[model samples]
Target chain A: MSAPPTPPDPTSDAAMTRRSFLRGTAAFGGLTALAASLAPLRELSDFSSTEQFLQKYYKEMTPSDMAKVIARIEREVQHQYGVRPHVRDLKPMDGVEFVYCLNLTRCIGCRKCVHACVAENNQSRNPEIQYIRVLKMPHGSMDVEKGDHNYKDAQVPDKGFFYMPVQCQQCKNPPCVKVCPVNATWQEKDGITVIDYDWCIGCRYCEAACPYFARRFNFTKPEIPKDRLNPEMAYLGNRPRKMGVMEKCHFCIQRTRAGKYPACLEVCPVGARKFGNILDPESEVSHILREKRVFIQLKEEMGTSPRFYYYFDK
Target chain B: MDPRPTRPGNSKSSRTNLWLGGLTVGFLGLAGLFLAGTRSPRPARADIPPVDKKFLETTPWRQTYADLVKAKEDLSDYDCYGCHEKNKPPPIRFDDKGKIIIPKEHANIVMGHGSHDRNDLCYNCHNEQNLETLQVRDGRQVKFDNIPLLCGSCHGPTLRDWDAGAHGRTSGFWDRKLGEAQRLSCANCHNPHSPRIPPREPAPGPHTLHETTPPAQPGH
Candidate 1:
């Protein structure tokens, strides 16, 4: 639509001569080529695959590849939660492995550990969001691998009963990490497996894949009172999650990162918990494990390379 | 969201996956819990050693009998033979009605019966013949003061719960008035013959809680 201006009529001899001389050369192909290139406008519709088109978490994608994912995540959170939080790309701290152990022998049937985990994790108010279940075991039983969590209140023994608590095993070869199609759940360098909540599609593949019965599905929206919420938090582990994703005990990652023991470990009154790095043989847990027979959870089979160890003193 | 998350190419069958994923996993979880709650099955019941039935028979050797008889002697219908005796005194067995009773000197001795672990060997602390000068703590040489030390032997578990401010002989020391503090004998809180945890009080409804049925009035 933009046309080149025509030469104005010359009012004087000098202008006429200039215009006439200029028109003499323009009368050739020189002017038309400029108009054709500018007028050849075309629209291209991109039909790349959804994976290629969606730039997701930088953790899931390289920095150059994550733009679309980050933007979409921001938009989704804004639309659904009315607030957009920064979706962080966290790498596990180096030379550290977040390990957990439960002293099943000493655990009482008091559900203090479960409650402590809830307060520490800032888990959604839904009871299903619970990361721990203290299985009320009968007295003189050591096989926690065989322990199940079907206990109702009546199962709490009025006399002669012990308890065993179970949670995420946090395996080295986490089956959940293997099954995530988008690699949303990953094992950090520190041996903690975390989910990129932003990248999670709520596929629940993680729940199906985990062999330990650890992960849980958040089928409903999470609602929590503001005051009850643990203000101190982390993105990969304990941050309150939305509906339609799988969550489980994160080993109290927020607390562990700061060199504090898990809340569940601290609240256990019976001294039923021991936590340390397996790599460091000098660590108290490692020493206890070396001195006493420290059996990995579910030691019989299904070797997931779990770091959690438990044993009873005779 | 998993309208069709399962793919035909995924090597595991969805049926197997569904079973392994849920029902199998849930069943295993249930099986594990059951295992934890049950007694070990390997130990054969027949292997248990036979109990010496006579070890639990009654006698007159127990020193506490003096306290029961002397302190509450006027109280009629006390079942000394039932709670403290099982067989008869050493020389006696069946009475006129074919019932067991204490015989003369052996009438005061407790051979054993029912939770003897908590009640056995009463004379070890008590003076079997002497009922007057009771042995007690503070070297009181009275029968009562010795109870704190006597009961502390096996009852240390509960007594420890008390010392650590957990269990036993709870006092009203808090109110300092109505909740005043006092130490009572283990007998005051728990009847040695039959001890039971008090049932939680039910919601106040129409339940007379009378002794009409009266637990069949256990016999000596």
Candidate 2:
């Protein structure tokens, strides 16, 4: 569609030689600078190729493959923490759909559950990663925006205000799992949304997608003391996460799988937290759902279908 | 081959006798060792306090609830029957303004129930005849552990909620097949005399993402 180029003039040969020499020098200089800057990236190349890139989709892996992967993770944790962790891949229990109910009237605004969760989950201590965030809301109001999360009161159950502790709702239709680009997060059969730390590319798409603000991104390597490190861990739950990953409460998978309550439920001083399988009619959570005026957070037309419920006595 | 070598003292019976003697010596040696082991002293006991029987029966998670009763027992020095058995105290004593007067014995008690105007008399909850146990609307005696029955007569809705797992703290297994569930008594959380829970220090709240200062507000 365009015209052909004209022939080069014989007299411009010297100019052409000089132009090529300058271009060559500039290209060489750029390459040298790039190699210097990228020197640190070479160390991370092994992690990318061996772990992240090679990780198959969770559903694609066979049982034998999962065992090998769990073994490798156990070795890596032992090397990093100098502690032999019991990393297990616990499947969902049959006929067990976990649900949690919190009594708003009895919660004394005690943050014991927060600290207990951190200790049990092996959360970063210095950066202070906690799953449960108790909001202090005023009396006769359910608006979380009007609530103060950083209240430092001399006494709790303050005359005109009440406390509402919020955490992962463990929604049946979790937005966090839906938004994971690499399928790094998914809901287990037992109604817990779990994250595969090594597979996550730290895109933070799930963090943005979560309606409950439940997902937490590991901006840096989680710093926990050697003494405080919880040796008990789960492959898809509370195992030590690498830097640049996403994690949230998995309902204490390590303990709950062993037929024990979550650390938060056990540590609550007022026994406000109630946890049980919703499948059983005789469960405390079932009783609460059937009898109490149970309510969920962000119960709009969004329809996340959360498992967490809050109720108060008349 | 040995048919002709049979002798009276050096027969096969002599070899069998030697084996039996060795077995007898080994058995006696083992018996002596066992007797020596049993003579050793047992390990010394640690100076730990006696564990409460209630705590031992209940799960460890419910130990805090058990501690509430233990703490009350530690402080309850005044016996209710000490004066009630010997001397007859006035059941109701009102001043000229019809305000309830605190007797010398109950002057230390703080009555902070907000609705004191309607039911201010002590006999409303405590039995005038028997001061040890609480009384219900139908004049039925209820133990301290069964205070919910007495409280339910007046607070029918609250009692219903409590039974339905809507009110009070229930600790232990949700499944009855796994373990026993322990519901805390009313007196575990609230003071019986005052009823109103006093204000206490709240645990530290959540640290915000940016650590921004909370907006200044009235009555914070």
Candidate 3:
């Protein structure tokens, strides 16, 4: 160079290059930080596959599409649990509306129904996911807030305490169904609130929306023992759910739709849990609704209009 | 236009100090989160029973008297003809205080029928005329399988509830159009000798995910 160049004036265009260089450096650093922050996404354990990502909504799926989807699920289940599960998408029966009646006096606070539900449904054993929560309420009290489910008594029917098992009420006007931003959950014609696990974005808005605390979140990949996995699964019922999805008691869609009593009803030693079609005048549930005194719906003030009813036959 | 004005607090040295403080706080927060995330799960309570095969097994202790009779090959095991004459009712001895002295041979039968032990007489349920038949209050004869009829005579309200499916277990199918609805008889659940159902051990409570302590009451 002929002569050393003098320092550029602070106000001159000559200083623009330095300023631009610093700006470029800042931009590069910001981009690198953003990339580093997003690195955790690569380790997503339950990332959706291309097929699952592209799957249509439950209502939109045709019979053929449903069959293909079921087959794919069956294959995936076989690969994971080493067992081929029979996954069928059962449609709601015409002229049938399900109603459940619980005889509060007959329930002896025995949690047999709870365990039976877990065994019937392919729920995770560790970090156990149970739909039914049997609350032990004090005598002369109907308030649910005063109830406790964690009492570890040597024998049930604890003195001065009665039992009330709570689950999805299957509301006529379901708040959970309405709050779903993704429309992943809906009430079927049979009055059963069903969740489409595939379409769920794991927002947990429905869980918050529910007043009875019925919905459960798959916080992690469900850990069910191979032997404990129920092979008789329905697509929107007892089928094994993946991580980051919402699930709840579907009133045993697979069994009830096929005209079989739910596992909870079958196992209840006291015969407290009663389920039947309200449409049939001769049905047991109809007779119960007509005859039983002191019948009350859980949280009727919430305007949920639950299909489930509790009665005291004194 | 220059958006940031040079204030006393926004000086170069103060700004650098603020950046250092922010970085340190961020690092500490991340470290705390990492520790919390990596912490081991709380040990399960020893008082809680493990959900084993026995705990999970559900044997509905309700078998109809008719079904039990049909299953038994030896009718004499439950038949009145085994110990007494077929047509005549067996003679029962009474103590001085009017309590029936149950024979040692039938020690298995506990006579605690009513709340105050009022309906404990053998002839009250079993027919004195014909030992094979059950006697209702109206003298209507009921078979062993139709014990609900015999029990219904006294427990009219319970009988009405049972008839309307408000009482007793109705298993099988809820919809009778599709399958049979198997309704359990009254004697299936309650022992005729002792009508009160005994207390039973409840199944294990819920073990929630990532909870160190016992699961807090849900939805409270």
Candidate 1 chain A: worst-modelled 10 consecutive residues by lDDT: A40-49
- Candidates sorted by TM-score, best first: 3, 2, 1
- Binned by DockQ into CAPRI classes (incorrect, acceptable, medium, high), candidate 3 is acceptable
Q: Which regions in candidate 1 have their CA more than 4 angstroms from the true location? A: A1-55, A60-91, A139-160, B1-220
Report the TM-score of the second chain of model 2 against its true counterpart: 0.58
**For model 3, what share of native contacts is present?**
0.52
Runs of candidate 3 with Cα error greater than 4 angstroms are: A1-48, B1-50, B54-58, B86-88, B211-220
TM-score of chain A of each: 0.69, 0.85, 0.86
DockQ of each: 0.01, 0.09, 0.28
Instruction: State TM-scores per candidate.
Output: 0.45, 0.71, 0.81
lDDT accuracy of residue A113 in candidate 3: 85
- DockQ for candidate 1, C-alpha atoms: 0.01
Clashes of each: 23, 1, 0
For DockQ, the strongest prediction is 3
CA shift of B23, model 2, Å: 89
* Candidate 1 per-residue C-alpha lDDT over B38-139 given as tens digits, one digit per residue, 9 for 90 to 100: 434532222212222222122212234335665665523233444344433323355585444545654544343235434333344443344333333333
